[model samples]
Target: MELKILKQDFSIGKLYDVSQADLQNEFCFFAKTDQENSLVCPTEFMPDDMIEREDGWRAFRIQGILDFSLIGILAEISSLLANHKIGIFVISTYNTDYILIKAENFERAVRVLADHGYEIIH
Candidate 1:
């Protein structure tokens, strides 16, 4: 599989609630449930109401659209990273899945993926 890195630094956060107006950034991922509202976005655009947050993430997305029928793509990648002791945070959109790694592990994760036959586009 081919992957392209996102340029922005990222953050993962939890919020009590979010209004549509609270979303000021185009490059953000928000998900809500009865129990929690979570956000994954560029650090610069983080919401002021975050109840908890973790910064220093870097992300890369699988290239091209993924069909819903596709299986194990995320598992395969995550497993590989797991073997290397790299943890990942994932976000799935209509088009594709993005994988976020801690900034400290980002370069090593990229190298491992590339070594394992995945194309890496910086």
Candidate 2:
């Protein structure tokens, strides 16, 4: 599988609550469950309602739309990064999965993935 590196830096945060009006762009992920309301969005779009937040993140996505029947794609990539001690946060949409790594580890993570034969596109 191929991976495309995203250009923007990101922020992962926990918000008290959210409404449609809170969302500013398509380049964001928001999940609300019994436990909490979470958001993964570009740094510039980070909202002020955050109860907790972490910045300095960068991201990439598995290239192309992934069929539901396909298995182990995320597991394989996560495992590879785990072995390198690079931590990650993931968000999945209907079409693909986005993996977030800390800014400090982004270059090393890219190099590791490239060395393992996963084509990395800028």
Candidate 3:
């Protein structure tokens, strides 16, 4: 699979019930569960008041719109990264998936993926 490194830095935030007003941004990616809303968004637009949040994550987008029938995309990528001991967080859209790794680990993750024959577009 092909992956593109997004230019923007992202965040995976655990917020106390995000207000509906906060969901207006088109770029925001999140899931609401019984516990809390887990969100992935560009760090610039994230509010300071979110009680528990971790910033400085980078996103790598998988290149193509995946058919629902296709499986193991995340599994394949995650397995490769896991063997290298790099942690990841993921978010998905109808088109494709985005994998976020800590900013500190971004460079090494890119290298690891490229070495494994997965194309990394910058």
Candidate 4:
């Protein structure tokens, strides 16, 4: 398997339990109002209200194309984070996967990923 790491600075933003109505027209990096409401999107299209609640953002890597064969890869990552007591919000697209963690745990998460042999570009 091949993996690519990206280096980028992420802004940490305050997390809020925004109402569904409040997020209807707003774009957000990560939105989770309830157990079923977690949604992660790109930073550029996030709505103003979403940005208004900013506390901190996390830097993540968009690994190679996502496929059924990659489930093990994600599971491995999840296990790693879980063992460290870090929470992760994962978003998957047709092409790749994105992982989100709170800003407070960013460094530790990166180190963990790196220690597991994942190359980090940033």
Determine which window of 10 residues in candidate 1 has minimal summed lDDT. 16-25
- Kindly give the stretch of ten consecutive residues in candidate 4 with the minimal lDDT sum: 20-29
Superposition error at 109 for model 1 (Å): 0.2
Worst 10 residues of 3 by lDDT: 17-26
Q: How close is candidate 4 to the true structure, as a TM-score?
A: 0.61
List, residue by residue over 1-122, the lDDT tens digit for candidate 3.
78998988886677766672267765788788888787778888777777578999998899999999999989999998999899998888899998999999999999999998999897
Top candidate by TM-score? 2
Q: Please write out the lDDT profile of model 1 over residues 12-57, one tens digit for every residue.
A: 9998677632576867888888888888889888876668999999
**Candidate 1 wrong stretches, greater than 4 Å:** none
Q: Write the per-residue lDDT of candidate 4 for residues 19-103, one digit (tens) a residue.
A: 5223442323444544433434444433345334333556565556666665587789889999999988666656766677777
- Pairs in clash, predicted candidate 2: none
Q: On residues 12-101, what C-alpha lDDT tens digit does candidate 2 reach at each position? A: 898877763257676889898899988888888887767899999999999999999999998989999999999999999999999999
RMSD per candidate (Å) reads 1.5, 1.4, 1.6, 5.6
**By TM-score, how accurate is candidate 3?**
0.90
Ranking by lDDT: 1, 2, 3, 4
Cα-based RMSD of candidate 3: 1.6
The positional error of residue 105 in candidate 1, measured at the CA in angstroms, is 0.4
